[model samples]
Target: MEQIIANGLYLGAQYALIALGLTLIFSLMNVLNFAHGQMYVFGGFVTYTVVVQLGLPFVVGLFASALALAVMGAAIEKFLFAPVVRRSKRDESTMLLAAGVAFFLDAVILLFFGEKQRGVPKVVNGVFNWDMRIIMPYDRILIGVLAVLLIVAFIVFMNYSRSGRAMRALAQDRTAAQLMGVDVSRYSMLGFALGAMLAGLVGGLLVTITGVNLGMGGPTSIKAFLMIMIGGAGVISGAIAGGFILGMMESVGLTVLSAYGDITYLAIFASLMVFLAVRPQGLMGKPWG
Candidate 1:
């Protein structure tokens, strides 16, 4: 039980960060960024290259991943999404564009990084065992703590920073924010970049544990969608709640259903479907008109 709780908390922290990015983009532009998972994969590859191929420190690689993804995200917003949003008459076009970008990134990752799984050396060695009931690797503990710190930092920024406030205003009401002298376009791009940065950061952090591969993107995106769906679409708090809930469910299912093999995920999805049928708007979402 103790090990399960520890595992759930670790996974939840990382999952929450991933969901936060996706939710931010949705709240701001109403665009479901299918490329988000690709962005994460791209970040992982960048870190792997820096740390493994280029012999850089893990910290440097992590920052490089975040910065690279941030630039890519801002460019995508400026060049692809923003133009399509302005010129296209339907939201479907943006969705298609996002899908195209996801495919493009997948190709790019495959070409540059190859299909082989890649991982960084552990930043720390050894395990932390408490009463033989809670055994966790030190590296996982480090990553988990860092993930929590990043989440807290994100919360602080959203509440106190100028850019964060501007983005929040834009997300809350674009027309009203514009009327209040907020630069909608600028903030929108910034928000997208921030979202991508969070995804990249998590990708880098998890590379040591999960050993990223080209095929991980789609499944990661699906998990993220499940999280947002469970919590409430476009709600920040909802994303966090959904992530933790899903994490705990996964931990419990993995432990209790080990004899059943892959049925754990099937059970989880079935449960989620039932739950969503009862509350389609999610835990904190308002009913769609």
Candidate 2:
């Protein structure tokens, strides 16, 4: 039971990281970025290339991946999303644009990497043992610690930084924020870049635990989308709450019923549907007035 709980927390941390990025983008842009999974895959590949291939340090690999994704995110905003926002059309166009980009990137990855599952060297090795039976990997512990630190840093950044405040203001009301002298485009790009960077971080951590491949992006994106929906769309706290909830549920389900893993996902979606029906705004999300 203790092991299950610990495992759940570890998985939940990753979910929260991914969902937080999704929520940030959705809150600011009112569009779901379908290409987010590609960012994760790309981040992992970049980290693998830098650390394993180039023999760079793990930290250097992470930084390189983050920087690469940040640039990609900024460029995407400038070229794709910016044009869509400028046009007078339904937000569906933005969704389509995002999907197109995701598809294109996925294809490119398949072309380049074929269909190989690649893994990264663990940043931390060995295990932690407690008392007589409880044991867990130090790497998982590291993931939890890093997740908490990143969450705290994100909160501080949003609350204390001027740019973060601007982002919040824009999320609340883009037109009002623009009138108040916020450079909407620049902030939009910033939000996207930040989200992408977070995704890259997730990718790096994930590669340590699981192998990465081209097809991994689609499932990851789906999981992220489910997390954002379950947590309540456009709510940061909701994302975090939703991630833990899903992670715990999954862990418990897996522990109790190993053969029925697929059923666990169904249960999760059912819960999400129920939540949407009852709260609509999400568990931690505020209802728009």
TM-score of each: 0.98, 0.95
Cα displacement (Å) at residue 99, model 2 = 0.4
**For model 1, how big is the CA root-mean-square deviation?**
1.0
Task: Give the Å error, residue 237, model 2.
Answer: 0.9
Query: lDDT per prediction?
Result: 0.92, 0.85
**Sliding window of 10 residues with minimal summed lDDT for model 1:** 280-289
> What is the per-residue lDDT of model 2 for residues 112-216, given as tens digits with 9 covering 90 to 100?
666789888778989999973668888889878887788878888988999999999998999999999999999999999999998988887777778589988
* Candidate 1 per-residue C-alpha lDDT over 1-289 given as tens digits, one digit per residue, 9 for 90 to 100: 9999999999999999999999999999999999989989999999999999999999999999999999999999999999999999888789999999999999999899999999999999999999999999999999999999999999899989998898888878889999999988998999999999999999999998898999999999999998999999888888899889889989999999999887878998999899989999899866750
Best candidate according to lDDT:
1
In candidate 2, list every pair of residues with a backbone clash. none
Off by over 4 Å in 1: none
> Whole-model lDDT for model 2 versus the true structure?
0.85
Residue 211 lDDT, candidate 2, scale 0-100:
59
| Alpha-carbon deviation at 44 in model 2, angstroms | 0.9
